[model samples]
Target: MDGTLIVGVDGSGAALRALDWAADEAVRGGFPLRIVHASGWEWYEGHEPSFGINRDVVRAQA
Candidate 1:
């Protein structure tokens, strides 16, 4: 089974803080971190989030 940490971000300082923490946790654990930004509904006529680029398993620190 695979583990993951999902964080929601919106280009704010607080969101960045959460992202930083999430990144650290992912580095501590052998799990993947998924950062998702609700790409705004205005441009949602037909848009799909990038699946392969930003999605990868991160190795824990040794």
Candidate 2:
């Protein structure tokens, strides 16, 4: 959307590879890059809130 390059990624190897590919494509197209991810199992069981979590923090931790 909005001519942006959006990509989804999980913790798996293939997902990471796809993310890298998307980043390259975004750079080549001169488009902004966006990452979109969804929780697969945490909705059923959770600890506290992720209210203040930041994207960079999550990425570094991952």
Highest TM-score among the candidates is held by which one? 2
Best candidate, lDDT-wise? 2
Per-model TM values vs. the true structure:
0.57, 0.63
Query: How many steric overlaps are in each model, in order?
Result: 0, 0
List model 2 lDDT by residue over 15-49, tens digit each: 88999999999988898998987556764365445
In terms of lDDT, the poorest run of 10 residues in model 1 is 53-62
Question: Per-residue alpha-carbon lDDT of model 1 for 2-60, expressed as tens digits?
Answer: 58989988768898999999999888886799998744455445545655323343112
- Give lDDT: candidate 2, residue 1: 30
- Report how far residue 3 has shifted in candidate 1, in Å: 1.3
lDDT of 1 at 5: 89
